[model samples]
Target chain A: GAGVSQSPSNKVTEKGKDVELRCDPISGHTALYWYRQRLGQGLEFLIYFQGNSAPDKSGLPSDRFSAERTGESVSTLTIQRTQQEDSAVYLCASSFFRGVQETQYFGPGTRLLVL
Target chain B: DQQVKQNSPSLSVQEGRISILNCDYTNSMFDYFLWYKKYPAEGPTFLISISSIKDKNEDGRFTVFLNKSAKHLSLHIVPSQPGDSAVYFCAASARVFGNEKLTFGTGTRLTIIP
Candidate 1:
């Protein structure tokens, strides 16, 4: 089966620019998550979307970070006014969301560089 | 503050030897723990997990042990192979709080030397 996929494996953007990262979750998956890993750091949760429920944006660092998922399919994470601190690998994950402890499958991720 | 912590940044183990990665959490609310492995240029893949109800859970060469009182957990790989060389991340979630989002520890890079 095809796994989660992300676009633009690598992106180089200037400071103050905006970048959009896309994620295609596995078919039938109802839960999608966005995370970012900074250099020498762990993966940080950014946002989460489950089915038609309201998205969880508590983990988003700032207002510049936002994500949208239509139904249970594709999702896009947008970072407005990118900054040097935002340079990281943006990762996407999806799960079946069976109301239990479900394993999250991840994508290859998009490495963003802000200069 | 980091809710989960992987003190060791890296570890090297001889092939066919036991490899142990440790993790600690500051949030007692966390009741579900998971381990993930990742290679270069890739995202993490689910490895193994242990629920707070159980002290240990084993699957093939991988075993996860939890110490709820200590707020600690460990992933043990027996007879480590070269293919096991990669970054291992420990994550925790608090289902009781109705939060499925995971809190991850800084990964531990494992190097299996053949």
Candidate 2:
């Protein structure tokens, strides 16, 4: 079975530009998540979507960051007015459901560079 | 503050030897612990997990041991193989309603020598 997958493996954008990263979760998965990993750091939770419930936006670092998932399928993470601090690898993951013990399968991730 | 911490940034172990990675957490609310392995240009894959109810969980050559009192956990790989060389991340999650997000550590790079 195909695992979670992200598009545009790499992206380069100038400061103040906007970038959208896409994620395709595994089929039948009802839970999707977005995370960011900075250089020499760990993965930071960004946002989460479970089934049709309201998305968890608590992890979004700033107002410029947002995500949307339609009908438990594809999801897009948009970062408006990109900043050098936003340069990092954006990863997506999905699970069968939003359970405490459920395993999250991750994607290859999209590396974004802001200059 | 980092809820999960892998004190060691890197470790090197000889093939056929035991490899142990350590992690600590400040939040006692964490009831589940997991280990993930990742290779260059790849996403992390789940290795093993341990629940708070039990102290240790083993799968094949991977075993995870947790200490609720000390808020510490360790991953042990027996007879480590060269192919096991990669970055290992420690993650934890509390069973809070409507909050299933995992908190991850900075990760430790492991190098296995053959």
The DockQ value obtained for model 1 is 0.85
lDDT of 2 by residue, B47-95 (tens): 9989899999999999999989999999999989999999999998887
Best by lDDT: 1
> Which CAPRI level is candidate 2?
high
Candidate 1 lDDT, B59-90, residue by residue in tens: 99999999888999999999899999999999
lDDT of 1 at A4: 96
- Which sections of candidate 2 miss by over 4 Å? A98-100
What TM-score number comes out for model 1?
A: 0.97
Chain A TM-score for each of the predictions = 0.96, 0.94
lDDT of 2: 0.91
RMSD of each: 1.0, 1.1
